[model samples]
Target: MWFTAGLLMAGAVVGNAVLIGQMSGREPVLVLARDVAWGQPVSGDDVKTVDLPVEVGAFAVREVAQAGIVGQVAGRNLHAGDLLAPDDLAAQAVPGPGQWVLGLRLEPGRYPARGLAPNDPIAVHPAPDEGVSSGSGTQQSGQEFPARVVHVSPPDADGAITADVLIPESTAPAAVEAAVGGAQVSLLGPPQK
Candidate 1:
């Protein structure tokens, strides 16, 4: 009887241990709290920790890794509830030195609506029918400075697409002045090759 009772007790203990192990929850991981635009900084309020299965969150950024997420710019447009990861963040501008960061407000016809994204190269030109000087003096309608595409804001109330572009400082003032002087500036297309 004593041996039988001991074996029963041992079985019960082992059974309890197995049950506890199986009932344990998965690790908590960081997920986006709201939609974030490209190049926007991530703050503590921008993320939340949630329990996710090991297999699902294995490649995700864990809650422990959320500490350094602040000040990191979004590498792409991030939707709400997205699983945060290292590749989703960037260190701001990747443009070369002495480049100008300028905002260009474009109407629907001025810039391409498809396949355009950040980090793409752009060619500058005078908007169609605007013969105002493009600062290059001779190449009035030809390509201007080779610029880098940055953030592209959603269409505003006026249906204009606002974009942040990086161009050489040498041509920055002249290009902006022309735009301000009622001379239309259009980014024709991404540089070929």
Candidate 2:
């Protein structure tokens, strides 16, 4: 009877060990507490730590690395509850050297009704000014250039949207010219997969 009791006790100890092992397998990793827009700096309040399985710790940013992540620019738009990965961060802010951020005022027909989001790839097309004769060779039409959406505001009372985009310095002049004459914006897709 003593031998049987010892065996039962040993079994209980082993079972408890297994349970502890499973619990310890999880490690702490940082996740976004709120949505972070691309090119925006991540503040301390934007992140929180959660315990996840060890397998996820391989690619997810560990909680201890939070110091390095804060103040860094986001490489892509990140949603709340997302596991923060290293690739989701950028080395510098938006409009990094040689880039310019421009705000384009778009009407209902000028932009997609589906709406635009940060980090979306877009093309700015120059629209001919009203009363400008299309027959005149001096007018340039159908000139579209690529730009990245930095921020988008809700439609105003007049159904106009304000979109701030990051464009290369070389294209700033053309983009400004287009904005002055009313440009058309087309959403290509998300900037990254």
lDDT of 2: 0.89
RMSD of each: 7.0, 3.7
- Top model by TM-score, which number? 2
Evaluate candidate 2 by giving its C-alpha RMSD to the native, one decimal.
Answer: 3.7
Off by over 4 Å in 1: 1-25, 93-98, 113-123, 128-139, 142-158, 168-193
The candidate scoring highest on lDDT is 2
Task: Give the runs in model 2 whose Cα sits over 4 Å from its true position.
Answer: 1-15, 134-142, 189-193
The 10-residue segment with the lowest total lDDT in model 1: 178-187
Over 25-106, each residue of candidate 1 has an lDDT whose tens digit, in order, gives: 4788899999776666888888999888778778788998888888788887778899998899887644447777787776
What's the distance in Å from true for residue 103, model 1? 1.2
In the range 132-185, model 2's lDDT, one tens digit per residue, is 655655665646789989999989999999999999998877888777878899
